[model samples]
Target: MSLRVLVVDDHPLYRDGLVTAIAAMPEIEVIGDAADGAAAVRAAKDLAPDVVVMDLHMPELNGIEATRQIVAERPATAVLVLTMLDGDDSVFAAMRAGARGYLLKGADRAEIRRALEAVAHGEVVFSSGIASRVLSFFAAGSAKSALSPFPSLTEREREILDLVARGLTNAAIAQRLVLSSKTVRNHVSNVFTKLQVAGRAEAVAQARDAGLGAP
Candidate 1:
């Protein structure tokens, strides 16, 4: 099935350009476009697109807040943030806001297409630069317990944990393990509970320290 996409950005040219680019892809259909976060939310509700290309900055509602609202209201709709911001804070915030993809605005058309495809499939996709930041966060180690509750995690969860420690997004992990992004996300949540940790950092730390999910 062709993926229905909603392009959300404040800049008229950028929004139009992105929509045009994606619409040209045979696998995608640009069903809607919005100039701000509020518009994006309304369009999402009305159009129910399979994916949303969101911007970080916007008037009335920011991309992060918009993503949160959209995901909360429509869990099946994947939000892919296309922004110039490459900071770790932005990356993590978008992920926490339920973004399934985070790519730089400078990304090429092929990269953009791949990200949309990945997100549409329920995977989390991050640009290489953002991926590096995620990896750096993992390298810093966890502040929580040094050991993991190994037996508490299933085999699949363990595999997912390894990928998580390396800072691969849900989409990347799913692609690596040949599992659906939804399944990977479910496993990630399970890993958090098993490790008694709340966030990605702690989960990775516990998994690494216990030698439970290391590559």
Candidate 2:
């Protein structure tokens, strides 16, 4: 049977091109496509495709959250992340959100097809570069843990937490990091969620205890 696939990306040209390419594959069917993450979620529910080719950054809802919701709603469905963002945070966040595979936007059609097939078969997949990073992270092991106590937090989140522990307000951190106040606030919220802290003070206390705010 042909694999049912849904292509999700905000870029019109790229999305169309991907759909065309996937449609040409012998055992894959491009069942549907969505321009953004919100539409992707709704389409996944309605179409019930075997695999979802997801893009990380999108309007309405980002791919990570969308992947999480889709996987939660339909455990049988698999999400294959296809995004330009290949940072550790993006990769680990997608994995944490239940994505079955990760591939950079630069991947060729053959690689994308292989990833979709692999994930549809209950296998985890990552591009060569991403796999190397994952392996290195595990290899570092305790050495990495000693440097950063919160393995769950992303690099940006850890940076924000360190500043918070040093008594920097959100505005200050935003200015220091050259990010918008809203973005900083969102990161802070994510940090609090990951740390399981109730509020800023609690997060600060935890960060300090972990030696994050050290000058």
Q: For residues 132-199, could you state the per-residue lDDT of candidate 2 as single tens digits? A: 87887778774454234677787898999999999999999999999999999999999988865579
Candidate with the greatest lDDT versus the true structure:
2
Candidate 1, residues 1-215: lDDT per residue as tens digits? 88999999999888888889999998789999998889999999999999999998787777888998899999999999999877554666677678999999999999999999999888879999778766655676731211223544566777788778877999998898898988888888877765555699767754554454545
Flag clash pairs in model 2: none
Model 1 TM-score? 0.66
- Candidate 1 regions exceeding 4 Å error are 143-215
Q: Each model's TM-score?
A: 0.66, 0.72
Local distance difference test, candidate 1: 0.81
